[model samples]
Target chain A: MDMLEQYLPFFTKLTPQQQAVLSQNTTRHTAKKGEIVHNGSLDCIGILILVRGQFRVFTLSEEGREITLYRLWERDICLLSASCMLNSIQFDVSVEAKKETEYWKIPASVYRKVMQQAAPMANYTGELLAARFSDVMWLMDQILYKRMDSRLAAFLLEESQLEGGRELKMTHEAIARHLGSAREVVTRMLKYFQSEGLVALSRGSVTISDETGLRKLAEESLR
Target chain B: MDMLEQYLPFFTKLTPQQQAVLSQNTTRHTAKKGEIVHNGSLDCIGILILVRGQFRVFTLSEEGREITLYRLWERDICLLSASCMLNSIQFDVSVEAKKETEYWKIPASVYRKVMQQAAPMANYTGELLAARFSDVMWLMDQILYKRMDSRLAAFLLEESQLEGGRELKMTHEAIARHLGSAREVVTRMLKYFQSEGLVALSRGSVTISDETGLRKLAEESLR
Candidate 1:
């Protein structure tokens, strides 16, 4: 199966006739690092499904701070922006390629038409949206109750699990911005981790040396 | 025009035709103050639409602290228990009537059938859920950076506006729980507000004397 076929849900469940219609409507694109797939002011387009690499979904505060709301990877669909197509509302969050990424952008009009004709597709979309709602609620809980250090640790653990690697290609500034904290604070924390032999940091990169120690720190700081 | 009309988005957009179907299927109930509409373990059989009075949606943390997630008034459809309906997942939050309330409960199966048959109703429900997603994101932002005092002030402003009155039916303990702060802290802040001639407080109630002043306090504390 191709990238789009592998990533899009309900494709297999669709009748061959239905799949042919969708294949004709969907377009694939490659985004370079730092390229924005969608901006807050953009007109509502179709949902984008990440096929390869990573993207960050974020919004700017009134005070000009960038708050990271979600990290999207392979097989994840961006439904937050999907509402815009139905209501004519501009996208509220921007999607940027964190690395060289491939995604299938399906037009909302075609998707709607297909959904109208295919009950399974409509149900799948609804289920996908409901899952996103649950994930947003979970993120809200973390923001309300989890400390910054613990949140940062959780972020690292999540990324590690996603990429299946200890080495992280992220700068302290990037991590700090994602955590909604100051770069200096993240730098100091990284130094502390290094002294404690929990992590090794080099220029613009970090490798976890002790996952168990990091988990302990996360639990301790969460309390 | 009835309570069913107000909650048309929850099931299907009620045409004069479909509206009649809903009126026949739904049952209305009066929830007394402090009544639990749905607990954490209850099977979610239907969607609940508040027709009158108020309700609070909260979840208890592992440490046994109540975290206020949402407040619902007339015409608001509750979706926190949606996961229970979709996946049979246990509800993590509890819905309780904050005051004597009237609501209509429609079975989940019936609601799904309506959406499948009615395009307008599907679109309306989609829009409502999208707005809810936006609200959740805003609340996450508040939780991340806004101090407890600012959150409390914002909550007061929101609730007061909803009531369309200066007098709010809430106690300091209630406000503290909503703001995720200690009761003593809320009491101290109310005293500060009273000293500044911004509000007057009594048991179970507070009256805003200076709306502009409170708005300013909320904005400043948010910074």
Candidate 2:
């Protein structure tokens, strides 16, 4: 499948003609590691489909603390900010390349026009929005019902699955920030996991050695 | 302006023919206080317009906890749960009347047909979905960043505004559940607020004496 086909689920169903229009209209851009794809002020719409590499979606607090809400990799679309394009508001979150990345930036106007003329496009948008709504609901549930340690464990599990490997290119401090906890707390947990032989942690990376053990820990903590 | 007129922003851009079809094809129902409009198994679509009174949009967890995610009042529509109809899945949440409420329940087929034939309906659904997305984001922000006290205070202020009065009808236990905290915590916070001259509590109601003070407290707690 092509790039558009890979990212098709992120959008509404489209006819061949509408798909061709989108394919022709979408522009691919490359960003080096740490480069910002769209800052908080850019007023653009349509989905940002990560075709290659990884990116971090985050917002800064008033005290300059960065809150990492999500991490995106290949085939994932930034629907959170992309949906905002319909309202003409400046982007609320910034997208920065976690590594050298290539993505397609489609225009909101083109997408809207095609959606108006295509049944599949409208259905696709409905499905995408519904999925996003479910995601936000799950995140809310995690924040409300889970403890910091459980949240951290779940994040680790999610990251491991996303990377399709035991190795994670994330520091303890980074994980702490994502879980909204202190670095020291994360360090203690990591030490505990390391002692149990569940994970191996080095200076800037972690590798899960006992997936079943980690999952069991998460379940027990949740209970 | 009529009740439907408040929704004109969504459909104003559509052609007259489309507006006529939407206006004629829509169905309206009145729900008495505490009545359920849609339950977990109901599959209905179209926009639910709150023409009068109020409704509570909530979900029940597996543990039997009732989580009130949103309160829908006059002129507001329940755009989030419209997904169940589109996806043909069980409703993720249920809508119940907080007071005797009247609403328009447009069928999904009618809505889709209107969107195809009418520019206004299409515009309305798009704009409504965008607003719902923002509302979810704001709720997520509150859940993730705000403390229990702050969340409770914000909830109180919001409830006061929704009721259009200084007195709120909700009980302390209900408020505690909404904040996802213990009832003891809510009682303690209420006492503190009372000592601070921010609120006066009774058997099943809370009356705000110092709205400005409560807002200040919430703001401080958020920081």
Candidate 3:
């Protein structure tokens, strides 16, 4: 069995003929770190199932500011790269390889054909789509309802957790891109946090100084 | 032909057997104005297709702040109502009757069965899902990239165009909910707009005093 079959919902239920078609269509692809795996304008990139590494999905402003929509981990399937082949996706969403990445790509036509053929496959596609919508909605809720201070505090904590330490080696510009904010705004807020003894800021790094205080500030947006 | 059939992509291509099952499952339902049509906790509400009037889809914060995701006008179909049945969708999304509305409701089980049986129906669902993802992305773009002044200006201009008049009869709280901001923030922006001679504000109403100036302000966020 092809490794890609693991990612498919009830793959065994697919007719042997259908399975072979998918196997033929699925191709292994890789991208170097920082490479754009999918450009918004480039249509029909197809369904990407990450086998290893990470992908950052984001929207880029005209001024080149980027706000991340979500990140894809190993085993995550990206139906978004195939947006044009689907329909009515009016906004631009680009995906970049955040690290050296390996994935399996299935052309949109084959995926559509297989999905239409199998009930499980179609349901799987719907599930993926609904999941993405939920992520976007959740982010919107945070940005709209949570104060910037709360969001920034939560983000810093999130980074610290991901890096497995209190000290984060991330520049203000990098933090702003992830939070979908301006670098200056992030810097000003970090300074405020520093003054309040919540976090200690140094050149290109932020260290969790007052863990309890920072956690309380971040708790506002935690839910 | 059932009116519901018209909404389905390639309805004619569906086997007559499938068509009959769909028609049997779909039923017309109506809601009064301001009615909560679908609560996030209620699962398997299935899909909603608006026939007449309007629906507002939004998220409610714990603090009672509301941020609209998008609205469903006449002939729009809503899948978020059926989130639980679809899978993942870990966040809350509620829908309400913005006005007295009539719609066709197909139970999640039936829709899933039909969609799996028909390729065109599955494609149609995919299209709708992609379109919605685009809408959410666009809204996120506006909130992240555009300044509050630009957003407020755009919102006022949008209201004027929607009402077909310069005078918009809405409270500050109402504007704040739609814009996903605080009432104080909205009031402050309105006052600034008024001071700039861009708009005239009165009790529960705002009149666009300078259309050209307003458009220019709104234009920054237009694209």
Candidate 4:
């Protein structure tokens, strides 16, 4: 499929003239893993649609701790990154390439213009925003109500599923960053998990030695 | 100003036919305080715009603990309540009238149709969704990064401002529910605050005796 056809199916709903306008405006871009694609821009440079690879969208604290809000993978449309363009949304989130990522950057002006003219695009945008808001609500529930051990177990299980492997090539510090926790806290918890024979940690990687144990731990309700 | 003229200027941007559709489809609603307005269906009821009084929108854990996501005051548009009708947005949010409130409820189907046709309405909808998402992100930051004492103090200050008084007519359980914590935890913290001369507790209310002290403590950065 062509760029417009692949990333935005609503492209077909647009008139040929609008389609030509979109094609004329958008640029295809690629970045290597670990690159800071958007350095916490209040003024969004562009709206990104991940064509392949992964991107981690996160918020930062004054003390420099980071928490991953959500991740964008293939075919995901990013709206929060362009905070200024979207009136009433005041986001200070930064985006980083979690893997070698390719995406289409739609200039905020063009995206807004098309959305104004195309009902399909407008409806799709609303759906994307609502979905993102729901994700944040779910995270709030987890952090406020769930226990740290259970959250960690859940994270590990999710990471294993995402990677499709028993071994997770990630450091404790990385895990702490993702969970918005202290490195010492994550280290202590990982050591405890190791003692329980649920996971084996070596250097910067964790191997799921007992999936059932981890699953049970994840499901454990703590008050 | 009339309903559309007063609450939504976007109505003017629509054609006469579109305005008629909106007028024909919307209902003016009033509810007493403490009413459970929206029970959080996967299928949304309508798009609500608060014209008078206050409404609290919150999420409840399986354990029944509730943490407020945000509040809707006059002129606030509540899109989250109509989750299912908006494709891809799956929200489980319950809304209650915090005070005797009056609002305009636009039928979900009508709102969606109008949004699909009117660029101004679509743009406004995007703005509302983006704004709500930002609020959720801020809440997540507070829960993960800030200490309980600071969070509680901030909440009290905000409540005082909202109620226009130094004394808050709320119970420990009420505060705990807002913070998504146990009542005992809230009671302990309130006692601690009382011991520090930050507040005075009565039968069912908390009076801020030392606003400066509470503000200072709230501003204290925790490592």
Chain A TM-scores of all predicted models? 0.78, 0.58, 0.68, 0.68
Q: Using lDDT as the measure, what is the rank order of every candidate, best first?
A: 4, 3, 1, 2
Candidate 3 per-residue C-alpha lDDT over A1-223 given as tens digits, one digit per residue, 9 for 90 to 100: 4776688765777888989999988899899999998998766689999999988887788768766677889989997888766658787779999889999999988888777667667667877887887777766665667566788888888888899999999999999999787797688678767755689998989998987877876775432
Q: Indicate the fraction of true inter-chain contacts that candidate 4 also forms.
A: 0.79
Q: What lDDT is reached at residue B189 by model 4?
A: 95
Local distance difference test values of all predictions, in order:
0.71, 0.69, 0.82, 0.83
- Identify the candidate with maximal DockQ: 4
For each candidate, C-alpha RMSD in Å?
A: 8.2, 8.4, 7.6, 7.5
Q: Give a tens-digit lDDT track for model 4, residues B49-72.
A: 899999899887666778898999
| lDDT tens digits, residue span A1-223, model 4 | 2578777878888889888888898898999999988878545777898989988888888789876777888999887666667777766888888889998888988888888888788778887888887767655665676566788998999999999999999999999999887787688678767755689999999999999988976885343
Per-residue C-alpha lDDT of model 2 across residues A120-210, encoded as one tens digit per residue: 5555565555555565554455445544446666788999999998899898889988877668768866765675568898889999888
lDDT of 3 by residue, B1-223 (tens): 3776677655787888988888888889999999999987665598999989999998887778788888899889998887665667777778999889999998988877887767667767877887877888888888767878888888888878866999999999999898877788899889999999999999989899998898898887655
True-structure Cα RMSD, model 3: 7.6
Q: What is the DockQ score, from 0 to 1, of model 2? A: 0.29
The runs of at least 3 residues in candidate 4 whose Cα sits more than 4 Å from the true structure, single-residue gaps closed, are: A148-223, B221-223
Q: Write the per-residue lDDT of candidate 1 for residues A79-116, one digit (tens) a residue.
A: 66555555523237777898999988888777777766
Question: Where's the lowest-lDDT run of ten residues in candidate 1 chain B?
Answer: B82-91
Per-candidate TM-score against the hidden true structure: 0.73, 0.72, 0.81, 0.83
Model 3 bad stretches (over 4 Å)? A116-118, A148-223
- How would the candidate models be sorted by DockQ, starting from the highest? 4, 3, 2, 1
Docking quality class, candidate 2: acceptable
Who is ahead in DockQ, 2 or 4? 4
